[model samples]
Target: MSALGLKIIDESVQQANIWINEVDYRVGLVNKQRAYRLLRAVLHALRDQLTPDTAAHLSAQLPIFVRGIFYEGYNPSSMPAAIRDKDDFIARVVAIFGPEPPEDITGAIGGVFDVLDARLSPGEMAQLRGQMARDIRALFAD
Candidate 1:
């Protein structure tokens, strides 16, 4: 048993770490913090673009800890934000980093998307893609 005496929490932590590590690997980032930033930014951008119901559905598939990250600062009322194109979606993710953003933000975000694709169910991935604009959908392309 973990120090917290909760197997679920331990599993969630492990899963979250695996996710972050995969993102770092895929993005070629040496810094886990940068990987985390990219992951959080990409998740928020995608979450905001999904309807509240769809967002919740996606969240349900996430590890407990990652689910928290997915919902951080989420305002469902403003959801499915009119991010109709890739530029708009990328802009939103970049906005979170302020100035002096990462060198390859798009690639990094794509890494996060890749992690999502590898982890989530194919049906869920398809639903998530269906919610996105064409340009944004290209990021998830194999």
Candidate 2:
């Protein structure tokens, strides 16, 4: 059923698609591209907020393609950028979304967190959530 023919590559791609589709479904997005924007934005914003060590550990658990997306513009030396609070984090995501912003930014962000809850190990997710500021953590609260 994999058009790629190579089983491992095909399976990895399928796993990545599952996450993307889940994000799309959770956000009620009719457009896959829009869902991708949301995922990429949130992933990058969250990655920059984590300590380099924690970020690496978290990315290691991501699916192959998703991992690449998570690390797209990463610079460990300049990382764990002083994104101390929720507004700063939301501002970063809004900048990523650019002109056509979502009507419900909180919902969009929460939607990504909701899908990731299933993909990530509960312990890892809990630790990562704990490290973030309370306001930011609320964005991911169930």
Candidate 3:
């Protein structure tokens, strides 16, 4: 289970890294509209890889990212609470990906989660990290 979890995490990280690189490259060359479109495309691609339940949850959350990219001078605080939303996202990912996450990728999964959680408040972020760790342990228990 640990091995599988690692694999899933690794694959997710690789995909995310590639997506970020692509977004950076596109942002350098495109207008705001085009850059946002590229970000949407990346989100869509990532969404496709998620389980239906996880995808639905994330789909609802994705508008946050879109608004950040498209709206001028948008404050993150003005948007809906990311801390609350991110907990759900992390939970969904753990639930959906736990059963069949690839082997040898646990570190990658941990890394991606670490990076995503960095945006949260310290207390809320620690709670999410603890939840993820617990979830991983639960996955390996059986």
Best by TM-score: 1
Window of ten residues with lowest summed lDDT in model 2: 94-103
Candidate with best lDDT: 2
Q: Kindly give the stretch of ten consecutive residues in candidate 1 with the minimal lDDT sum.
A: 96-105
The residue-by-residue lDDT of candidate 1 on 46-100, one tens digit each, is 9988999999999999999999999999999987788979999889999875665
Candidate numbers, best TM-score first, in rank order: 1, 2, 3
Q: On TM-score, who's better, 1 or 2? A: 1
* lDDT tens digits by residue: candidate 2, 44-106: 999998889999889888998999989998999998888979999999998877767678998
TM-score of each model, in listed order? 0.94, 0.94, 0.28
- Give candidate 3 misplaced runs (Cα > 4 Å): 1-26, 64-142
- lDDT for every model? 0.88, 0.89, 0.38
lDDT of 3 by residue, 73-140 (tens): 32333333222333343444444444433232333334433433433345544443343334443222
- The lDDT, on a scale of 0 to 1, for candidate 1 is 0.88
C-alpha lDDT of residue 59 in model 1: 95
